[model samples]
Target: MNFCKRTDLILVLITAVVTTSILGFALSNQVVAQINGTQQQNQMDYTGFHSNIEQIIAHLEKAEYNKFFNNNTLTLGHALHPIEEVLTLVTIPLSTADSNLNDTYFKDLYQLSALASPGNSTVDEFDNKSKSSIELSNEVVATVIPATVLSTTEHNVSVIKDLLTISGSEYKEGVAGGNIILELEYQDGSAFMDRAYTLFNNTQNISNDTQSVTKLLSDFSNLTDSVQSLKEPAVIDQIIQKMNIGLSPNDNSTTSDVSSSQTSQDYIDTIRGLLNEVITAYESNDKIKAKELTTIAYLDNFEYIEASIGKELSDRGEALLREKLREQIDGNASIDEIKQNIADINKVLDDSAGFLDSNPK
Candidate 1:
C-alpha cells in the first residue's frame, strides 16, 4: 500500500506540471497575438496617413499645373480645397509624431496655399513653394510610415476609389440643371479628378490587375475631359460606373473628419502658443521671424478653426484681427502695439472657446 501511494503522488505531481506548462505556452501565444494585432492597426493608420500625404503632393502639382499650364487661378484655388480637407487629417497625427515638423510643414503648406491663390504669387514663387511642400510631404511619408508596410495595394485602391467618388459627387453638385451653376464646386470637382487620376496612375504602375487597371485609366482620361467640358452629371456617373468603383464605406471618414477630430480648446491652445512665439520673436527684433510666425498662427492654427470661430465672431471680425497682427509685425509696431493686436485676437478666440464649450460637438 505504501508503494502504490508513492506512484499515485508522482502521477499527480506530473499532471500539475504539464497543465501549468500548457497554460504558460497558451498565455504567451495570446500576448504575441495581441501585440501583432496592435502593430497591424498602427500600420493601417500610418498607411492611410501616407496616402493622404501623397494626394496632397499630387494636388499641389495639379494646382501648379492649372496656374501655369492652364492659366486658371480659379482651378488652382479649387485645388487647395482638397488640400485643406486632407491637411486637417494630417495636422493632429503629424503634431503627435513630431511637433516641430508639424509647424514647419504647415508653414510650407500655408505658403503654398497662399502662393497658389489667385494673383497672389508669381510662377516662380508658386513653383518654389510647391516644390518645398512636395519634398516635405515625401519626407513626412518616410518618417511616419514604416518601409515594410509601404505598398498595401488594397488600401491604395480603396483610397483611389474614394477620391473618385468624391470627384463625381462634387462634379454633380457643380453641374446641376445641365449647367455649371457653382463654379467653385466645378473647379473643386476637377481638382478631385486630378487627384484621383494621379493616385490611379501611381497605383496602376505597380498593380497586377493589368486588364482592369488599363480600363480604369482610359475611363479616368475620358472622365477628366468630360468634367472639364462641363458634361452632364449622368455622363460622369456612367464613366464612374465603367470604372467599377465604390466609395469606401468604412475608411472614407478618415479624410473629412478633421473638424470633429479635435476640440476647440485644442486649436485655441495651438494658436496661443504660436502667438506667444510671435511675441518672443518680436522682442528679439527678429522681424522676419515674427512675421513668419504670425503667418503660421493664422494660416496653420486660426485657419483650421476659422469657420467654427466665425460662428461666434464674424468672419470679417476675425480677419481684421489677423490682419491687424500681420500689419503690426510688418510695420514695425512697438511691442505694446503687437501685444495689443495679440490681445484682440485672443479675446475673439476666448469668445469662440466659450461658444464651443457651451455647444460641444
Candidate 2:
C-alpha cells in the first residue's frame, strides 16, 4: 500500500509541472503576437498621417493652378473636396501617445494650411493671374460688342456694380463711387496712351504749330515712361503692398491713413452725380451736355491725385476730348447728328471706365 501511494504522488507532481510549462509557453506566444500586431498598426498609422498631408498639399496646389492658370472650374471643385478628408486624417494621430509623430504631422499640416490661405506670395501671384484672365476676357468681349450694349446691359452692369459694391463695402464703405471714379481715371489714361502713338506720328503733317507737336511728343514720351514704370516689378510690388495694407483687417491703422488720402465722401458724391448725368444725357439725347459732363466727371477724380501727375493726365484727356469733338462737328452738323456723336462718345467713356471700375488695380 505505501509503494502505491508514493508512486501516485510522484505522478501528480509530474503532471502539475507539465501543465504549468504548457501554460507559460502559450502565454508567451500570445504576448508576442499582440506586440507584432501593435507594431503593424503603428506603421500603418504613420503612413496614413504622412499621406494625408501630401494629399492636402496636392489639392491646394491644384486649386491654385486651376484658379490662376488653367481656369479649370471642374478641377477647382475637385481640389477642395479632399481638404476635409485631410483634416480628418491629420487629427487621428493626434490622439495617439507618440509626441514625435504628432509634432511631425502637425508641422506639415500647418504648412498646408498656410498655402491654402491668402497673404502668402504664391496666393498673390494666383490672384494677379486670375484677375488678368478676367480682364483679358472682358476686353475680348468688349471688342466684339458695341459700347452701348456693354454699358447698358442689365446683366453686365449688375455684375460689375455688385463687384464694385462688394469691394468698396469691404475696403472703403460709402466710397464705392470714388472707387468707380479712380478706375475711370486709369482707363481714360490708358486710352489716351493708345492714341498717343498715332497722334504723335500724324501731328508733324497735320499741325503748323511746332509747340503743339513738341508738346504732343513730350506727352507721348511721358506716357510711355509711365507705362514702362508700371511694368516694373517694384511698381507692381508697391501696388500690391498698398492693396494689402489698405485691404487687410490687421493693417487697419495704415489703411485708414491711406484711405483718408485717396478717397473721401465728396469724391463719392461727385462720381455719383457724374454717373447720373451720364445716364440722363444718354437717355435724353443731349450730345453737348453728355460730352462735357463725361470730360468733367473724369477730370474730377484727378483732383485726388498729386498736382503734377494729375494735371498731365487731365491735359491728355482734354486734348483727346477736343479731337473727338472736332471730328463730330466736321462729320455731322445737324442736331440729331450731334446727339448721336455725344451718345457714341459717352458710351465709349462709360465702357472704358466701367472696365477699370470693375477691377480696382
Candidate 3:
C-alpha cells in the first residue's frame, strides 16, 4: 500500500510539472509577440516621420528656388523654420530606436537651420547644408524601410506632375506679357519647375524607353529657358498636357484636379495633427483649448478642402465627424471615448484619401 501511494504522488508531481512548462512556453511566446507588435508600430511611426521629412524637403527646395532666382532670404528662413519643430517631434522615438542616428539627424538639422537663417547664410552654404541633410535622410530611409517599398514609379510621376502643374499656375500668377509682375509668385513657380526637372531626371533610368525620355528632357530644357524669359504659362501647361497623355491615355482628370489630390492629402495630414493635439489637450483637462483646436481644425483646415473632397463620399462623413468630435468634447467624454472617436475620424479621412487618390477630382 505504501509503495502504491508513493507511485501515485510521483505521477501527480510529474503531470503538474509538465503542465507548468507548457503554460510557461505559451506565456513567453505571447510576451515576445507583444514586443514584436510594438516594434512594428514603431517602424510605422518612423515611416510617417520619413513622409514629413519629404514635405520639409519640398519646402526647402522652394526656398532654394527663391534664393537662387532673386536672393530672397526672407522666404528661405520662413520655409525652413518648420524643420526644427518637426525634428523635435521625432526626437524621442528616434532616440529609442538608435541613439546615434538621432544624434546625426539633429546635428545636420541644426546646422542646416543655422545656415538658412535669413540675411546670414549664402546660397552656397545653404546648399551644402541641404545636401548633407538630404543624404542623412537617405541613410535613415535605407535603414528603416526596404528598398522595394521606397516608392513606385507611378507615384513618382504623379508627384512630378503635381509639381509641374503647380509650377505653371505659379508662373501664371507671377508673370504677364513676358515680364515678371510678381517676383515672389514667379520665384515659387520657377522653384517648383526646378524640382520637377530634378525628379524627372532621376526617373529616367527606370523608364522603358530611352528615346522618349531624352525627348522629354530636351523639352524640359527648352521650357526652363522659356520660363526664365517669362513666356506664356499656357506653353508650360501644353507641355505638361502632352506628358500627361503619354502617362495616362484613358484618364481625363484635369491637371488642377490632379494637383488638388496632393493638396487634399496635405490638408488631411494637417487635420490629423490637430486632432492629435485635441486629444492631448482634452486628456490634460484643458477643455477650452481642446474645443478651440477642434474648431480650428474644421474651420481653418477642413473647410478649405471641403469643396475639393469628393462630393459623394465626404458630404456627410466629414461633417458628422466634426460634429461628433464636438459632442465628445462638450460632454466631457472619457479618454478612451475621445481616442475612439478620433480613430473613427481617421478612418473617414483614409476613405477620403482613397477616393481622392483614385478619382483625383
Which segments of candidate 1 are over 4 A away from where they belong?
Answer: 1-51, 69-84, 116-120, 204-209, 241-361
Q: Candidate 1: TM-score? A: 0.51
Full ranking by lDDT: 1, 3, 2
- lDDT, candidate 2, 1-361, per-residue tens: 0001112343344334323322222111111110101121323233223223333333444455545544443233323323222332333233233334434443433333333333333656554543443343233333333455444323232222222211222122111222322322232233323322432353224345566556645644653454334443233224333433322224343422333444433443454465455456545544333443443444333233222223333344334343344334223345555456455544544544444456444
Q: What is the lDDT of residue 116 in candidate 2?
A: 33
The local distance difference test score of each candidate is 0.58, 0.35, 0.57
Weakest 10 consecutive residues of candidate 1 by summed lDDT: 28-37
lDDT of 3: 0.57
Instruction: Give the lowest summed-lDDT range of ten residues in model 2.
Output: 28-37
Clash counts for the predictions, in order: 0, 0, 0
Instruction: Give per-residue CA lDDT, model 1, range 1-361, as digits (tens).
Output: 0001112343344334323322222111111110101121222365446546765766777667677765554535534543334554455455555656866776666556555545667877777777777888888876655565555656666556555554665566567666887665576567767766766666534455667566666777898888877788778867765554422323444332332344567767877877787799789875544554565455435655654554347364345445567556545589998898788888888888877777675
C-alpha RMSD of each candidate structure in angstroms: 22.3, 34.8, 19.2
**Candidate 1 pairs with clashing backbones:** none
